[model samples]
Target: MMFENTLAFARKLDAEDPLKNYREQFYIPQQNGKEVIYFCGNSLGLQPKSVRKLVEEELEKWQNLAVEGHFTGDNPWFTYHKQFKEPVARLVGALPHEVIVMNNLTTNLHLMLVSFYQPSGKRIKIITEKGAFPSDQYALESQVRYHGHNPDEVIIELAPREGECTLRTEDIISTIEQHSQELALVMMGGLNYYTGQVFDMQAITDAGHKAGAYVGFDLAHAAGNIMLDLHAWQVDFAVWCTYKYLNSSPGGVAGAFIHEKHAANTQLPRFAGWWGHREEERFQMKKGFIPIYGADGWQLANAPILLMAAHKAALAIFDEVGMEAVSRKSKKLTGYLEYMLKSNPVMEKRIQIITPENPAERGSQLSLLVKEGGKQLFEAISAAGVIADWREPNAIRVAPAPLYNSFEEVFRFHEILSGHLR
Candidate 1:
């Protein structure tokens, strides 16, 4: 696995990559008529080439069938979301009945919180990571307030130890234990959006359960980027967006997973809709709510057919490649990115990587904390055709998605960055 900071070495790796052909399956964006080295999959994944046709087919169905599309198309709009269960379940390592494709990420998070974030009497605190994605922060804070509790008192945010950029698993577990008496929910991002640190979900879930708390994860950054076994981890619930890493279109339909143990509990509180009613009893339009027996019970509305079509197109690629193969290539691709960045003398002095160095503790992203000229450097790379993302203040996040990004592109980015640093 020796890596050399040379174009030849990068090309060699690209030639050897089993997933190399996947690059052609995506429509890479162009700058001045040339393809940009796209490393922003952590933000928005590149569109799959098949997306247009998949979406068009749905359009054609609507055009031809109109209202009849609901029950008559090849994939009936009535149950279009059902087709996603198996692929998404496989992607996140859950039982087919345990997962469902539904609303956008934050909405689903709120729905999950309604059912799982019950706070009774003195046990009413929620534990989450500090500097979480703003949507998560707002969701947790608002949910606390809705229950008539003060956020400062009811929410405990675990911070990284001073001088470290990522949360240590020990620190997280200890914090749960520290507030065990009052902890009602333990929720965190499976991967930190800024630092790209992958939390130990199984450990966190076990610790939460032992402390008598419901455990959930916001897998917005982790779902398609890493291997997740939500069921085996005994996670009570989880939610993720499809756009990033999953490569569905912008604002694609999001997904949720509820462990079978929780899914069968019909008495669980939720904000339900008719789509979540038992299929056989749904058309009766009775006054009482009869919930579906699994994760489908959490659905708030019928499927968004077009969004589901886009999601299906991207997931088909994941199903074909399999997460195991994707994980293997991801480790090597991201490792090469890290190696090339470190090997550049100018970069070594000008930037610091905030992401975890261990592959197991991270996914495909590397968050570089630029020491000087951060904005200018980011702009320079952009002008040079490297489409990486810049967060506020100083960090530049680059993710080499295994499905479409290539090793040579990573090398070219380093070359562009090195030239800019000079």
Candidate 2:
């Protein structure tokens, strides 16, 4: 764990890492044709080389077979949608039947709310963190409004205690208990985007159920970055985008999970299209809708082969590096980054990490609360070829994806920050 120099330390970590080989699998960025330090996987992930080959096969199938490609070609488009289920299901720790690749994140959230959030008059409240992702907030609001209810009356936002950057578990549990009688759905992000706090999902799910509510999550920041046991936790439902940690390309197809218990409950209403219909009954043009049980019941259209192909490429890598191994390396990589950042503060006062110090409480992302010329300092970091993101007034986000990021990269980024801060 010791470095002859910072670079040597990083190279050593890379040498000992079982997952280090994956760095070559991605299309890393360059400045003057040299690889740049990439710490932004929490935003847009680097592309996998296999993505092109996967997409090209589909393109070739389209060019040659045309409509016949649905049942022809290497991976026929006929059952193309089903191809994504197994890998994605394993990635999030769910049964194959319990997961499906489908629409974008917000859209899937809205669709899930339709069947799961059956809020009856008085017991129609929704619970979430106060400053959640904008898409999640918007979906929750639209769902409330769609139910002929005012969001102000039915939405309960849990906030951190004064001066605390992260939500206390006690606060979340108490908020759910306080609203038990009126609570209907507990929809939240698995990890906070700004604070980098990983919520205790198992505890939260248990509490929500005790409150007589359906518990679900937006794992946009959690999937691939953290270990999840949604089925074991009894999470009623969940949705996530693959573009972030999954490295599936931007605007990639999203995936969802529905507990096995909800699979056969046909009484639950869903917004169905041909894809959700029973495959045998689908072409039959049946008079009444019959859903494919479990996660398959949520689909509304055919899969986008191009996007799913890209996703399959990424998932293949994840399949190679198990979640436990990825998460194990993640803590060390990010922990090292944090240590280096704190080390630079004496050299410069403008840098302060808002992310929680506890390793179990955060993924790879670290949000920095700058003390001076915040945006200017961030721009300087960018100019120095460190590609992290600056959000809002004064915070910058850097995530060292275990798949490609290295200890040396962390050291190099700090070298740039120290230059400006000093």
Q: Give the candidate number with the greatest lDDT.
A: 1
Please identify model 2 stretches exceeding 4 Å from their true place.
1-5
lDDT digits (tens) for residues 265-335 of candidate 2: 98997898889988887888878888999899888998888998899899999998889999999998988
Tell me the lDDT of model 1 at 286: 88
Each candidate: what lDDT? 0.93, 0.88
Instruction: Show where candidate 1 strays beyond 4 Å.
Output: none
Q: What's the C-alpha lDDT at position 47 in model 1?
A: 92
Give the distance in Å from residue 135's predicted Cα in candidate 2 to where it truly belongs. Answer: 0.3
For candidate 1, the 10 contiguous residues with the lowest summed lDDT are: 73-82
Error of 1 at 54 (Å): 1.3
Q: Against the true structure, whose TM-score is highest?
A: 1
